[model samples]
Target: MTELVGIVLVSHSPELAAGLRSLLGQIGSAAVPVAVAGGTDDSRIGTSYARIAAAVKDADRGAGVLVLPDLGSSVLTARAVLEDHPREGVVIADAPFVEGAVAAAVTAAAGADLTAVLTAATEARHVSKL
Candidate 1:
């Protein structure tokens, strides 16, 4: 089975999540599933957490979930959601948002393991001035 990767974007703003989506599209990896949380109107903490949790849980193949967050609340909500569903293949990385998104998209497109994709995203976060 060719495991499909699931991307969970949890940012302080919806724009960040949207931007990640666009990047993923540009990278041309349509097979990867993406779930987004947080944005301009998503101020309710618990709600965002719930959305993220649902997204992760609903990813079809359940190969793995990679979470990328922007700021404070985004991080907190992602953490809470991940805690609530600590599946073995899930990985929540503290990486730079946009950069990590692109790296993840590219890695996922290449059919890399979820762990490798998350690690690459984490490494991409520190590559340069962003």
Candidate 2:
């Protein structure tokens, strides 16, 4: 069985994470395993590493995980999550939230190789005019 690629969106607001999931869904990735981790209007740190880890394992056929974050906390939190729950046949790419989320989701949906995914994420991160 092919491994389903997983997407973990970490942001200051849960809305952004949900938005990414919704966007990816619109892109026809509803079947793919995607997860959102962050604070909601009333809930903070809505999702835990255990959840993410389970999602990764559930999706880990071999595809990998692409982690997108809103800010530095997201970055640190993501690292912590991955560190706590390590998954084989799974890779977490460090990419900026906005562009990287879209690019990573698209790449993962298409079963793009890890190199391509990471490259796209890297390029997306540094492409801002500012």
Candidate 3:
């Protein structure tokens, strides 16, 4: 069986990142590798390249990695990590933070490839909330 794509959630708040990971845990996270890169080394609010890069490494299991960053610096920090370590299967998803993460995780758990997982994440932006 092909390895399932991994997910790395990047957020400015450690609690937010962890909480979402917990939520995904109750979802279809059994076969999905999910990691969080939230806050700085000092545990303060903000993003960290080292943390994000490490999470990506931890989540990846020979299939691929999908990075979902929250607002502002989280996005920039994720981009920097991608720049420093340009791996073939590591790609950042340009989608809403919470919705995208949930969608990505669900799709990836279904044994989808990186492209399908990415598409699921990005397409989440269109999910109607009315």
Per-residue lDDT tens digits for candidate 2, residues 9-45, read 7677777777878988898767557777767435565
Better of 1 and 3 by lDDT: 3
User: lDDT value for candidate 3?
Assistant: 0.93
Q: Residue 100 of model 1: what lDDT?
A: 87
* Candidate 2 least-lDDT 10 residues: 46-55
lDDT of 3 at 94: 95
Off by over 4 Å in 2: 40-42, 45-51, 58-61, 126-130
lDDT of 3 by residue, 1-130 (tens): 7789999999999999999999988985767999999999889999989999999999999999999999999999999999989999999999998899889999998888999999999999999989
- Could you tell me the TM-score of candidate 2? 0.75
Q: Which candidate model has the greater lDDT, 2 or 3?
A: 3
lDDT of each: 0.76, 0.66, 0.93
Query: Which stretches in model 1 have alpha-carbon errors above 4 Å?
Result: 40-47
TM-score each candidate. 0.84, 0.75, 0.97
> Candidate 1 on 34-113: residue-level lDDT in tens?
77776544454323766677767765366787887777877887788778767888878888888888888788878888
| Residue 117 displacement in candidate 1 (angstroms) | 0.5
